[model samples]
Target: MAESKIPIYGAIGANVAIAVTKFIVAGITGSSAMLSEGIHSAVDTFNGVLLLVGLHLSKRPATAEHPFGHGKELYFWSLIVAVLIFGLGGGVSFYEGIQHIRQPEPMRDPTWNYVVLAAAALFEGTSFLIALRQFRGQARGVPFWEALDRSKDPTTYTVLAEDSAALAGLAVAALGIYFSHALNMPMLDGVASVVIGVLLAGVAVLLIAQSRGLLIGEGVRPETAKAIRAVVMEQPSVEGVGRVLSMYVGPDEVLVVVDVDFKDDTPTGDAADAIAAIEKQVRARFPMIRRIFVEASDAPGGDASAARPGAAS
Candidate 1:
């Protein structure tokens, strides 16, 4: 099944609106924490743009050079977006926040900052809900952090993480603003800004790590591996499955490669026919499995080390 881009587009709109409001409020109130949060949201908006572009390009049909399709391109561009958020957005905010901490400015007009933070939180929360709704089945069996790790849908993860962190940062900023104003301490606002920056940086690092694995072509999970193996072994002529390898080629698709052993008496043509039938069966059964290659061998459970990349006969 092809992944939908609706949630990501909605996230982008939310980020734009939140970023504008936060920046304007930060400027009006001169709150370092609010400013840092604003910067984070701005970067999130830009990242959304990158994700949308990647999603569009990744949908293209296979070409000669990339016969498997351009699905992994999503990971590459998402990684680029993560790096920019880490360095440009998170890093810059952290540095500025530190500087503000050193020369603290009195927190002025806490009320307006908190109100804006509340509004931003509401917007980000809505975006997060949309992303979660879209990812319902995809993240079902996985833990939260592990889901992010195993997910091939970069845009969805990005939206979820950015919105969640935005909400948390708003809370932190609100606390900092309140304390600094209530206690008449100028340094607290800067400290809150620094905390928000660190949080953003941490989230960016996580996104980078997840995207990097996809770019390098990580294998499918144990459950998926078992399913592919079972499907391949069900063929009549096939004695057993040797090694089954599958990788996420897109958000909702995988490329499956399997090595199968045939009966000793199996003729070359018979083996070929069996292989074709297994491939067709597997594809028909699993919509998420987009491509398959099956190779026949006489040896039972062919040598693990001898497994070639494609369907070998």
Candidate 2:
């Protein structure tokens, strides 16, 4: 969580520099593919700024008007990022590609496009590596895809996906420029621009799906819920476990409800002691779990008893 800002900051700086350089080179060469690369970099730069703003807004302290704090602000901005990519990056490139295909303008001084593409690749590659490292760290022992699915922090994986797409777009732009000159078919450059746009569109779709799921309140992973059950059941005072629910209130912050059956003969003092102990143990075991609701009932492991008011055994 502490390392979340690095990718956005790095990408912002790198994309800003690369965007300017690519625009200059595109102007010099008059390559449609080169111009598309410039536009891609510019869009990425803007997205980085949006992400940082989201991070800041998400950090706001909880108020009466917004008791949950502004954690979901990140999700809202991430969705915006997706829409922007689809509109500005993909839509514009698609329009430009088709226009260029019809016009078929020959590229002049194409060597400069190659130079700018190489530089952009280097910067994008570095940002991608940083994002990949953070994502791997978050995965822990789980499979990468599973970790991505369970992860509450969208910022890390979003950066990784965006940088990955950026790198791919840069490579496509270079190839398009090269093949257009080599084969003497200016239309190939236009095709390359369309391909870059397609790549961005795909990435946008992925980000949108992930952000939407988060906003809709996807619960804890099966493994995590299972672990929570084990922790509650292991306590001596617990007779049996019932329904256990987990919800993420923020990245690295979870609100949990664990229903347990206590021995009939257990005194109120004993139940209180057990509840306190369970809360402490669970919090220590999973730092992400910030709040817990443990209820006791006469019956064990039934939906009827799960919803019934809990009484002291």
> Could you give candidate 2's per-residue lDDT for residues 10-76 as a string of tens digits?
8888999999998888888888888887888899899989988889899998899976678888889
Candidate that scores best on TM-score: 2
- Candidate 2, superposed: residue stretches over 4 Å from native: 140-146, 299-313
What residue pairs are clashing in model 1?
A: none
- What TM-score quantifies how close candidate 1 is to the native fold? 0.88
TM-score against native, each model: 0.88, 0.90
| Model 1 poorest 10 in a row by lDDT | 304-313
- Quick one: how many clashes does candidate 2 have? 0
* Per-residue C-alpha lDDT of model 1 across residues 139-250, encoded as one tens digit per residue: 8777777776666788788888877888888898889888988998878888887888788889889988888777777777888778777876776776787777778887
Instruction: Return the TM-score for candidate 2, rounded to 2 decimals.
Output: 0.90
Candidate 2 lDDT trough over 10 residues, lowest sum: 304-313
**Native-vs-model 1 lDDT?**
0.78
